[model samples]
Target: MDIIVEGIKQAFILLFTLDREVLGITWLSLKISGSATFLSMFIGVSVGTAVALNQFPGRRFVVSLINTGMGLPPVVVGLFVTIFLWRNGPFGFLEMLYTPTAIVIAQTVIATPIVMGISLAAIQSLPANLRLQILALGATRLQMVWILVKEARLPLLAAVMAGFGGVISEVGASMMVGGNIKGYSRVLTTATVMETGKGNFAIAMALSIILLLLAFTVNVVLTQIQQRDRPR
Candidate 1:
């Protein structure tokens, strides 16, 4: 109990003091996760909507695969990403291992399916005749898709939240791909893990607190946008 309280106090101190290391880690975390979520949103929404609207062979199988990917284990993702980025591995000529960019790639892999699955469901949940209605009104297919996406904005926003949440809180993939290099690739989750491993319980707890607060702040802003203009 005392430890927990002390940790909270330390977290505030770190925040109030504008600790450079903590702030840098926090910013990098947001930047990487934000970029990952944005990329996932672009790819996931496009592919998910296409799949939702079209009738094709093996469509069910593809959807099942996407659903499976939503729950893909982070450590497993980390392992494959690490392997692919290894010095002698394919595409290793770019030499991206143990870097922030590598972390972003792993996180993008982690978040894309989550966003894709939710986007697929959101587009599918609309009234069956909605797409036809839009097309019947002289809207082109592209315009119809745009309208449908607009209609599904609320749930799509939720997908953003989920994707960002997943990547921001994950440590395994970041640690594996980033090597948790201080002042470069270090982030709250990896830092917390490192501190705990070194028995710096107070520092670990403080980092954890900061991470939770960061997640909460981002979600709060997103939630506000989501709820705004919602029907009373």
Candidate 2:
């Protein structure tokens, strides 16, 4: 307990001192996770809309796959991206290994499932009457989808928040694909681990604190949005 308290004290000092390494890691984490979340939102929303509105063979199976993907282990995602980007892998010629792009790819893989699954739930939760009413009004398929999506905006926003939280806090994928390279691909979570291994508890604690604050801020904002959009 004493050790932990001491670490916290030193971490605050580092924060106030404007430690360069700490700032660098925080910036990289935000940059990579933000990019990954943006990409995931694009793909996930498109696929989720298609799956929700279209009835076809194996639709249930596809949604089941997405649900399973929501719980996918970050380490597994890391391994998958690593192999695909490795020197002997299919896209090895692109030489994307150990880069910020690789980290973004890994994070995207992890986040997409969350976004897709959440979107599915949101779309499915809408009232059947509402859907039927829209159809009765002779709305086009695209118009119907947009209406449903707008009605479920709160849930979709929650999905985005969940994906952002997952990607921002994940260390395994970031470390594996980004190589935790100093001043390069290093992020807050990966940097915390690296600093701890080097016996730098102060910086590690500081990074952890910053990460927690970011996660809290995201959740708070999402909750506000959800409340504002809640059906009265």
Candidate 3:
């Protein structure tokens, strides 16, 4: 009880004073997660839409794989990513291990499937004849895809929220790939974990509160846009 109250008070103090370490970790969290979510959005939306609109061999199998991937464990993702980025691994020449960029890659892998699965469902839910109608209206294949994407914007926004939410709150991959070095790759989730492990519950709680605030702020903005664009 006392600890919880103290933690909340500490959180406000950190925010109000703009503590350098706290601010840096907060910003880095946003940067890594934001970059991951953006990349996931692009790749996920494109591939999911392609898969949803096209019929080819093994399509069902591919979608099943994607749906499975949406629930991939963060620790498993961390293990594979760490192995791939380790010295002497396939892409080891790039030397990206234990860096913020590595965290972004791991997070992207974590978030992409989530966004893709949601987007696949969103696009597939639209009217079946919508594509044909767009083409009959003299729209090119590219334009048709764009219009369909626009029509599914609402649910797509949900995809963004889900993707961002997944990656931003994930710590296992971030810790494994980032090394949690202070002022370098340390992020809110990893920082909280470190603080907690050291019995710094107050600090941990403060970081957790800040993380919730950050996630809430981003979701709020996205929700506002989503509601504003809702169809009457």
Candidate 4:
């Protein structure tokens, strides 16, 4: 349709000209999502590995919780985060509501379970005897964990992609926590939503295209690394 064509053209123009607003939103989007994904990687990988390798009481319950968390609704996450950050709420003294940092927190909550769940599955998929093999070779517990993690690097990278994909594409939590203030917390997803609400379909489409392109570029790089590391 004419709208799709026009939107594509607008997207091209925005990228080619590096429109300040567009560029700023794009960069902020990356920053917030990237930060969230990175933080999630650390927390998710650690917790997942710990849970996978240990046999604690109520382990299944914990795993069930993590699995449930992976599918949590973004709006629910945003609402809780907002409430916690609101004045007179717990930890309200930090005053992070409606800020980019708040967005990061909400996004981290959204992405953490995704990454953790995938990581749990990845580590669990490893050879059961592998841990014993390493220990038989006199590897320390710490070194054994590190080696296991390295062996599972491929799927762990996939977790990164999934986590980044989840957070970057999510709009609800970002809108609620970010407030979408121009040049401040406005991101690609929120900007697109605002434009769409205002009937600027072309602009909204353009932003959507840009977001897809961005996600694609990052995934391409990750995919290349993943393929390169594949076992012959």
Candidate 5:
């Protein structure tokens, strides 16, 4: 009880003071997760749409793989990514391990499948004859795809929310790949973990509050867009 109250006070203090380190961690968390979500949106929406619209022999298997990937553990992702970026690993020549870029890469991997799976479902939920109707009106294949995407924009936006939520709250992969170095790769999630491990419950809770507030603010904006676009 006291601890929770103290934590709330700490959170308020941190916000009021605009502590440099806390602000930096918060900003880095947003930047990395935002980039990951954006990159995932591009690749995920494209691949998902292509998969949904095409008829290929191995398409189901590919979708199953993606669906499975949507639930992939962040720690496992961290392990493989860490191995890949290790000194002697395949991409070791790039020397990206323990860097902010590495965190982005790991987070992108974590978020992509989630966005892709949701995107696939959103595209598939459209009217079956919609494509035919568009083509019947002399629309090119490219234009048809564009129109279908526009029709499904609302649920696709949900994909954005889910992808951003997943990565922004993720801590294990960020810790594994980013090394949680101060002022470099440290983020709200990892910072909270470190503080908790050090028995600084109030600090940890403050970080958690900040993370929640940040996520809530972004989601509020997205939700407004989503609701505003709702069909009458």
Candidate 6:
């Protein structure tokens, strides 16, 4: 308990002092996770809208695949991306392994399925009458999709928050793909692990504090959005 209290004290001091290494790791974490979340939103929203609104051959199969992807293990994603980007793999020419970009790719892959699954559920939960009314008004397919997305905005934001939370806290993919290199690809979670392994609790505590704050802030914002969008 004394050690824990001392660690918190040191963490607060480090935070107030604006330690360069701490700030750098925080910045890199935000950059990679933010980019991953953006990419996930782009792909997930499009794919979710298509699955929710359109009917075509193999639609069920596609959605089932997405549902499966929602449960994909981060380590599996990391391994798959590592192999594909390794020297002997097809895209090995790009030589992207052990970099921030590789971490982003892995994180994005892990996040997209989550966003897709949640968005699909949100869209499907909308009132059927709203969809039928839009069709009756002769709204184009694109316009109808826009309407549904607008109605589902709150849930979509929740999906984005969830994806951001996952990627920001995940260490498996980041460590494997980014190699968790100091002063470069190291992020809060992976850094915390590395620091702890070296018996350095101060930096680890600081990083953990920052990561907790980020997750808490995102969840609070998501809750507010949900309340604002709730039916009056």
Q: Give the TM-score of candidate 4.
A: 0.96
> Candidate 6, which ten residues in sequence have the lowest lDDT sum?
223-232
Predictions ranked by lDDT, top down? 3, 5, 4, 1, 6, 2
Q: Tens digit of lDDT per residue, candidate 5, span 145-183? A: 999999999989999899999999999999999999999
Error (Å) of candidate 2 at residue 62 is 0.9
In candidate 3, what are the lDDT values of residues 1-232, reduced to their tens digit? 8977887787778778888998899999999999999999999999999999999999999999999999999999999999999999998999999999999999999999999999999999999999999999999999999999999999998998999999999999999999999999999999999999998877787789889999999999999998995667
Best by lDDT: 3
| Candidate 2: stretches off by over 4 Å | 228-232
- Cα deviation at 15, candidate 5, in Å, is 1.4
Clashing pairs in 6: none
lDDT of 5: 0.93
Model 2: pairs clashing at backbone N, Cα or C within 3 Å: none
Which should have the higher TM-score, number 2 or number 3? 3
For all candidates in order, the CA lDDT equals 0.92, 0.90, 0.95, 0.93, 0.93, 0.91
Task: State which candidate, 2 or 3, has the greater lDDT.
Answer: 3
Quote the positional error of residue 87 for candidate 5 in Å. Answer: 1.2
Candidate 1 per-residue lDDT over residues 10-104, each given as its tens digit: 87787789888888988999999999999999999999999999999999999999999999889899999999989999968889999999999
TM-score of 3: 0.97
Q: How many angstroms is residue 201 displaced in model 1 relative to the true structure, after the best TM-score fit? A: 2.0
Residue 80 error for model 4, in Å? 0.3
Cα deviation at 136, candidate 4, in Å, is: 0.9
Give the per-residue lDDT digits (tens) of candidate 6, residues 1-232: 9889898999999999999999999999989999999999999988887788778999889899989998889999999999999989988999999999999999999999999989998898999789989988999978988989998998888899888988998998899989989998999999999999998898799999999988897689778977874676
Provide the global lDDT of candidate 1 against the true structure. 0.92
Q: Which of candidates 3 and 5 is the stronger one according to lDDT? A: 3
